[model samples]
Target: MKEQSRRLGEDSIGSLMARLSIPAFIGMFVMGMYNIVDTIFVSYGVGPNGVAALSIAFPVQMILMAMAAMFGIGGASIISRSLGAGEQKTANTVFHQVIWLVIFSSLLIAILTFIFIDPLITMFGAPAEIHQMTKEFLEIILLGAVFQSFGMGMNNIVRSEGNAKTAMLTMIISAVINMILNPIFIMGLDMGVRGSALATLIAQAIGAAWLLFYFLSGKSTLSLKGFGLRIDVKLGLRIIAIGFPSFIMMASGSVVTIAVNWMLQIYGGTMAIAAFGVANRIASFAIMPINGVTQGMQPIVGFNYGSKQFGRVSHSVKLGMLVATILSLIAFAVAEIFPAELARIFSSDPVLIAESEEALRIMLLAAPTIGFQIVCGGLYQALGKARISFIISLMRQIICLVPLLLILPNFFGLSGVWYAFPIADFLAFSVCVVILSTTWRKVFRETEMVR
Candidate 1:
C-alpha cells in the first residue's frame, strides 16, 4: 500500500494517472454521494419543498467550500512540490499555518451568518415556506461551520503528503455516519429538514476532528511542529495565489446557484425551484467523476512541474482530457435515460417529478461537454496556472453563463433558464481549446530550456 504512494514521480504517465485517479474517483464519488444521500432522505422525509430549501442553502454552503478550496488547493500545490524536492520541514509549516487559516475563517463566517441569517435568506429569493426551511437548516449547519471548513481545507494536505488513502478515509467514514444518522433522525426521531441538517453537521464535525488528529500524530510524515500562531505573510500569500483558481471556481458556482434560484423564483415558482435543485444535483454527480480525475492528476502535475519533468506533465494533461471526455459521455446517457427514476429517487412528489424532468432534460442537452471543460480547467490548476483556471471557471458561470441565464429566460421563460448551462459550457470548452493550445506552446518552450 505504501509502495503505491511512493511512485508518484517515478511512474510512467499512464501508471501515475491510474494510481492517482482510482482513489480520487472513489473518494470524490463518495464526496458527491454525501449530499446525494441527504437529497434522497430530504426528498422522501421532507418532500419537494425540503429539497428546494436544501437547494437554496447550497450557494451558501458553496461559499464556505470556496474558502476551503482556497487554502486547501493553494497550499497543497506548494506542498506537493516541496515534498517532491525533499523539503519536509517547509511542507509541515505550510500544513500547520493552513489549520490556523481554516479555523479563523470559519469563526468569522459563522458570526456574520448568525447575525443576519434571515436577511441572507431573503436575498437568496426564498419564498415564505422555503425561507422557513432554509433558515432552520442553515442555522443548525452554521453552528458547526468550523468542522466542515477545516475538514475540507485540510483533507487535500493529507493527500498531498502521500496519504490519499487517509484523505479518502475522512470522507468515507463521514459518509457512513451521515448515512446512518440521516434515517434515524429524519424518520425514527421525526426531525424533518432540521434533522437532515443536524445529521450533516455531526458528520462533518467528526471529519474535522479526524483530520486534525492525523497531523498531530507521530505516524504521519508531515507532523505539525509548534507552528507559531502568527501567520507568515510570504507563505500565506503563495497559498492564496495558488488557491485563487479553486476559489474562483467554487465562488462562481455559488454565484450561478444564487442567480438560478433567484430567476426560478421570479419566473418559475417553487415547482421550478424544485426542478432546478434536482437537475443540478444530478448534473453534479455526472461532472464529479471527471473532477476526481483532475484532482488525482493535480499532485502529479505539481510534483513533476516542481521536479522539472516537463514531458511527464504534458502527458498527464492529455490523459486527463481523454478520461474526462469518455466518462462524461457515459454519464450523459445515464441521466438522459433515467430522468424519472432519478427524480423519483430524490422525491415521490408528483409535481416536482413532472417539472424536474424538464429541468433535467434541458440542462443535460450538452452534457457530454462537461468532460471537456473539467479536464481543460483542471489541468491549468495542476500545472500551477492559477489565472487560467480562474478565467476558465468564470467563462461558464459569469461571462457566458450569467448573461445567457438572464437574457434567455426572459425570451423563453422557465425552460430558458435551464438551457443556459449547456450553452455556456459548450462555449467555454471552445475557449479552453484555444487557451490550452497556447499553454502547450509555453510548456514545450520551458521544457527545451531545461534540456
Candidate 2:
C-alpha cells in the first residue's frame, strides 16, 4: 500500500499518467459505448418515441449519479490525501462512510422517485405521447439505484487507492454485461425500452458485487472489516463539503437537461427532442476520453498536493490538460467532418438523421477548448479547494448555458437550442482560464513562502 502511494510522488509523470489514464480511458470509453449501444438498440426497436422517452428519463438517472458522485468523488479526495499523508485509518473511515452514504441516499432517492414518477417525468418535459414509456424505464432504473450508486461510488474509492486496474475492470464488466444483454432483452424478447433499463439494472448489480468482493476479500488497500455501519458526523460533513462541487456539476446537469427538453419540446416538438438525444449521446461519447484523463489526474494531484509536492502536482495538471486538449481536437474534427455518418449509427429515419446532424455540428463548435476547462475543474477538486471548484462547476451549465437556453430559443427557434451549447462552452472556457492562472500563482507563492 505504501509502495502504491509512493509511486504517485516518485514515478515519472508521463509514465505514471499513461499507466493510470489508459485503464481509466478504456473503462470510460467502454462505458460510453454502453450508452451509445443502448440508444442504438432502443432506436431500432422502438423508434424516435423511444429515444425521446429515454431523454426525458435521463435527468432522473443524472440525479442518481449525482448523489453517487457526491459521495464517491468527495470521499475519494479525502481518502487519497489521507493515504498520501500516511494516515491509513483516516482513509478507511472515509471509505466506510462513503459506502453507508450511498446506501441511505440511494434509498431516499428511489422512494421519492416511486412516489413522484408520473409528475417527475412530466416535469422533465415529457410529452403526453411518451409519458408512459418514460415512466416505465425510470421505475425499473430506480429499482437498481442502490447497486448503481454502490458501484459508481466504490469505483472512485478503488481508483483513489491506486487500484486503477480493478476500477477499470469494474466498468468493463458492467458495460460488457450491459452490451450483451441489451439485444437479448430488447430484440429477442421485443421488450423495448423497459428491456434496456432492466439490462442496465442487472449489470449495475453485478458490478457492485464485484467491488464488494474486492474490499472484503483483502485485495483492496482500504479494509471494510473494522468499520461497521457507524456514520461519523463530522467526517461525513467534510466529505460533503469536498464533494459538493461534483454534486452541483451533475445535479445542475440534470437541470440543464430538463431545460433543454422543455425548449426542444416548445420549438421543435418530439422529433427535435429525439434528435437532441442522439446528438447529445454522440457528443458525450466523444468527450469520454477527456473525462477519463481528468479521473486519472485526480488521485495524482490529490496525493501530491497533500504531500506538499507542488512540482509533481503542477506537472500532472499540465500533462492532463495537454492530453485532454489533443483528444478534444480529435473529437472536434470527427464531429465536424462526420456528423451525419455518426447520426446514422443510431437511427435510419431520414428526418431524424438530418436533425441530429445539424444539432451535432452546431452544438460542438467549441469542442477544442472544452478539454482545458474540464481539466481545470478537476485540478481544483483534486486540490480540495471546494469553493473554487464549485464555481467552476457552475460556470458551464448554470452560469452560462441555462441563460442561453432561455434566451437563444426566443430568437433563433430550435436552432437556438443547439447554439446554446458552444456559446456556453466558450464562455465557461474563458472563466476557467482566468481562475486557473490566478489560483496556480497563489498556490506556488504560498509554497515558496512556507519553504
Worst 10 residues of 2 by lDDT: 442-451
Residue 259 in model 1: shift from native, Å? 0.9
lDDT of 1: 0.82
Candidate 2 lDDT score relative to the true structure: 0.92
- Please provide, for model 2 over 1-451, each residue's C-alpha lDDT reduced to its tens digit, 9 standing for 90 to 100: 6566678778888887887899999999999999999999999999999999999999989988999999999999999988888889989989999999999999999999999889888899999999999988998999999999999999989888777888999999999999999999999999899999999999999999999988889878899878787989999998998889889988998999999999999999999999999999999999889988998899999888778888888889889999999999999999999999999999999999999999999999999999998898888888888898999999999999999999999999999999999999999999999998777787667667221
Q: How close is candidate 2 to the true structure, as a TM-score?
A: 0.98
TM-score of 1: 0.96
TM-score on alpha carbons, each prediction: 0.96, 0.98
**Per-model lDDT:** 0.82, 0.92
For each of the candidates, the C-alpha root-mean-square deviation to the true structure, in angstroms, is 1.9, 1.1
Candidate 2 colliding pairs: none
After superposition, the stretches of candidate 1 with alpha carbons farther than 4 Å from their true spots are 1-6, 447-451
- Candidate 2 lDDT at 98 equals 98
Give the Å shift of residue 74 in candidate 2. 0.8
